[model samples]
Target: MRASESDTWLAKMISPQSEDESEDDILYNDRKFSWSAGYPHWEIFGGGTRVVATDALTSSSLFSLTEAVAEIIKREKVTHAVLIQPVIDILMKEQIAIKLKKIVILGTVGFRSVLDCVGKICDELVNMYGMVEFGTIAAGSYRVNDVNTYKHKVLSVKPLPGVELKVTDDNGHLVPVGDRGLIQVRSQKRFTGYLNHASRWVDQLVRTGWLNSSDGGYITTDGFMVIEGRINGLMDVFGLKVYPFQVENAIKGMKAISNAVVIPIREKETKFCVPCAAVVYHPGSENTTQNIQEYIREEFAFTKENPIMASVYVPQVVVKFKTFPQTSNGKPDRHGIAAEVKRQIDPKKYECIE
Candidate 1:
């Protein structure tokens, strides 16, 4: 099917209005298309079909509760599967194996860690990037045997057909390849406007066609896109900018940490924001708070050229969590965790780095 038509069908399927509309009304709108018409069914494996499973909240756009139930009923052997990062984490924690041939992972945060865990189970693993506003933007896959060697490409995604991406500096000028900047996207099949939020749409539109993704990332010289994190999520510490993903990625790289989230917490006296990390350690890990803190210091200290800037990235306070609070869509609840971190931290005990 064409991209525009596919988008229209997806929008209708997930829109709030869809709850009131009948299946026929959703499938046979003004386009006059049938539900099964032109639906391409690819034989990804030898006579094996794909089965999807999601634990996301019902309100998630990825799949409705009803669709999830139907898919669950139809699933049997589960040769191919699609899952989000959180679901994959759960699988790893539970020590459950589905014995799948192929898997496609949806979300971005902590993708590398999850890929490392699941790469051994499946023959092929694909990392997909997309949002509700636009359909599948970019995707890349790695074979099971190449997992360790291709770790650098875990977050790299190549744009899909007809999708255009650019990284621009704060001044709205394009940056050189491999330089970090604000990421913007333009596509022929992109959503036009919000239901009643036209002004919001206008604010995000950089020009007539391009839309500001509000994401900070860089493009590689080889033409792959790498998303760092949300532009708004960047923390300013003593006049230095630090990306939470960079810190979280470093923390997760440690042998003990299973998952981690870094947030900016403002110091009471100076009112300056400092990075605080909440971590989930692997089962049976005997590492203490001091060990994790020392690890971060050593990791950031390796950069001799920017010791001052690297110091800002280190977390002043570290808290341990059994598991991260999750949002409705099953992603880590960063804001909620930040609130809890503030509550747990005693301002008098830990002072901000000067």
Candidate 2:
């Protein structure tokens, strides 16, 4: 909106929207607090009140996310801020870094990956943004983070006081410490089942009394958690297991790559799924499919003697992309990227055997 339209827009939008508004009235595409209306989830922590904010109302939210946070709150300063589901796309992280530096303890959700995105953006968050402690946080549609618990990995979160969470393997056994598995939760606050789809509730949500969260992560010795990614995205190639994050992480670590996604593309004739990559490289990067393949070979190929090198799950093809498509949740949409990659690959010309 223009400067003249500011007042007109302000008159229409009620900040921190009223608790009295109807549920249907409160939720929209841009608004974030759909679960609890517009009340910013507040916690009495670190002195005063710690306000949690997110890109609920994208246009309105980004204003608070990047600029005028303290002014919008009408406070001298915002001591603590928790961000969730806001910085989903990769490029937006730079925007957030440059703009969001006022709050002291800025807990955000930018880098849900294993690496702390603060490194990617540089330490300027402290000098420029008034940030002392900043890390990715764990908060989502179904649950809130343990108000008292804070950690480094953004996805590492503890369920609320009344909730019981379990990390389990494929056989339903509890994963040993440091090993990744599915996160399952049981709580009175949790939804019992989805309406009309009772069986889907069993398949997707309810696993006995516990709800299968589908999120993948590992618990630490001290009980802090580190989420990896979705367990359902696992791809199999020639009977070997391949994980998207594992391949993507390896690719991103390469010097030439700026961003990368390893997506599973199923071979139409053989029906065997092969891992392919969509890469975004630094400007003027001399990256080629052969070199990218070599990087993955060096990173993940088990050994020549182990047969994993021959059966390696590295990208068979590396297609260049200007940017990644955002998922509904605003994260990088690997499935969407895979669909685009499939269109470019000719099945008759290219082998899909990995």
Candidate 3:
């Protein structure tokens, strides 16, 4: 729609692996914009909508664009808004907690945008629209849990009446009440099919009426849905479940240890499973390795248990001029960090598992 909008589309088409193989100037604009969490420039796309851009969010000209949207929303009292948050900054988490009617998030895979708050508004919309016969739309199993939990989070499409809803777990087991699995719906209202693609949707549906969501979790023992982390993110620590987000959330509350990653490294001694976290200390704080270990033990106590043991040791905390390298979609790149950790520490000293 706008000249800057071309930049957003170009960014989407550019593959992450291709960037290293190409020239720097070819990938980005010379004009400095705080569009990304790092770097000199980032492209932003804005049409007619309310927007909120924080300085801490990213390094992109997006702030100027979002400011324009924010003014319009405040002035027009717009209800539904779609905005793309910067990659690392969880703008939805920040905004959902604030005053706004509803905001839809749009972004690419690397950006991995999420909608955190969707509480009361969904029910009102359902009441207003449910009576009218609507068509069905396909969604992952996690959507059921997300919708049930955030009952007020509204969706544009409603499944037609008489549509069958099925929920299952990752193991392909049909869960009973409160049990959660992948979800699949069958109804006449389902779309005719995909455009320019025929086989994409087939891979998602199964003969047993379950669609694999790739996200793992279960329905509540109380008939509610609970969404765990993605299956790809599943870390089998001696057969125990360990979620990186859970660990990161705990570490975020700690004093000096600002950010940490619980990477499975092979221990030299017992050859057992151990996690080594490469940490980033808070800016302008005197954070030594010993101080960080103590903080982990006292404040966010997650360690030494079956399935996993928390041998929380901060071998070294490197000081960075800014936040770390991020994925194209805006999420922190754990894979990239893991590679960096290999460079910093000997892999033989830590426990390593697939």
Candidate 4:
């Protein structure tokens, strides 16, 4: 290829977490390339068994995904893309809406996160892109048929053949539909056992032919699985169960915050411990730490109907970050972020939580 035709974008699949793993630059190649098939970068580049011409333009270090895509469309004469759901929110605002066709989201964090941003995606892109085929994947839980029309925009994951799903509570009892519980599945597709980690596999995964997904969810009347959060080892506050995603989504909804991550904060005085949120805000956001804390308090204010959950679920602190530290897989590094919070948090500011 000539220099003019060679402008492929290589997206960041993951980054190293620690200095010890500095030698390991987690990226895709011929062997591990299949893992990236569902991501935007792979769709752009990574030569494979594609019948169509999917010439990708590399743009890895950019802050705004939309901006990067915009450049690619202009330069590469691109017309379609298979992007993750999170990118659609920002991408919809750009002029690229008039270009793309398909929008496939590989839902690693569940389909609902994409669903939350679907309105903007459909409204902004659908009319322009001509009824875009936008959907997400949730391993064994969500399927192609699960993606429905706007009014019927609910997640319905049909368990595979010979896969029996069980949503059980703490004591392994079934909960009613729409009520959250541990998601256990006994499937032919499920792994029989780990290679050598017998104890770890038994303790964390397989139990009586059923695989504990370490996920929490509820089945709707229509057989749709509404994911709540991770079930294995969730963070707590004063003996009250709190989900990090719940708090993170709330913070992300704020006008000032562009991105958010909620992590477990270990406190000796607190009975169960507390939550700390590290956020990346919009440019020109005149938000102070007090304002951020106040916003969380108001958003998570206790309700009279059930004062317990709302009260305990609220964040004890919120910290600002230029960019959240990411794990090798491009996921938020909660532990690394927590350590940063500890370093930045003032004694006087956080003492109130105790």
lDDT per residue (tens digit) for residues 1-354 in model 3: 011112112321111222233444243334323333222222334331222223233454433445555565668877766454331133232242223555443222111113233443211111111101112232222132454454311122223355554566555557785443454445443222223333332445434332343333444444433343343554545556555544443444444443555566665676645455666644444465566555555544545452124443222233221344555444455677777766766555653454
lDDT of 4 by residue, 1-354 (tens): 000000022222222222333453343333322222223245334544432222343235324656776666658866545554345544543324434433444333433334433433332221111000111213322223433442222234555455567788876789998777877666444333333323342454444665555567678777756554454336667676766766765666566666677776655544346677788765556477577666666776755675556546666667888766754334455667777887887654453221
- Model 2, global lDDT: 0.48
TM-score of each: 0.73, 0.58, 0.46, 0.64
Ranked by TM-score, the better of candidates 1 and 2 is: 1
Clashing pairs in 2: 30-56, 30-57, 31-56, 31-57, 32-56, 101-129, 136-154
lDDT per residue (tens digit) for residues 63-103 in model 1: 24324533552477667776655455545555554556777
RMSD of each: 8.7, 11.3, 11.5, 10.5
lDDT of 1 at 122: 66
Candidate whose lDDT is highest? 1
> Which 10-residue window in model 2 sums to the lowest lDDT?
127-136
Compared with the true structure, all predictions reach lDDT values of 0.62, 0.48, 0.40, 0.50
Give the clashing pairs for model 1: none
The superposed Cα distance between candidate 2 and the true structure at residue 194, in angstroms, equals: 1.7
Candidate 3 residues lying further than 4 Å off, grouped into runs, are 1-99, 104-167, 175-206, 221-223, 239-261, 277-324, 346-348, 351-354
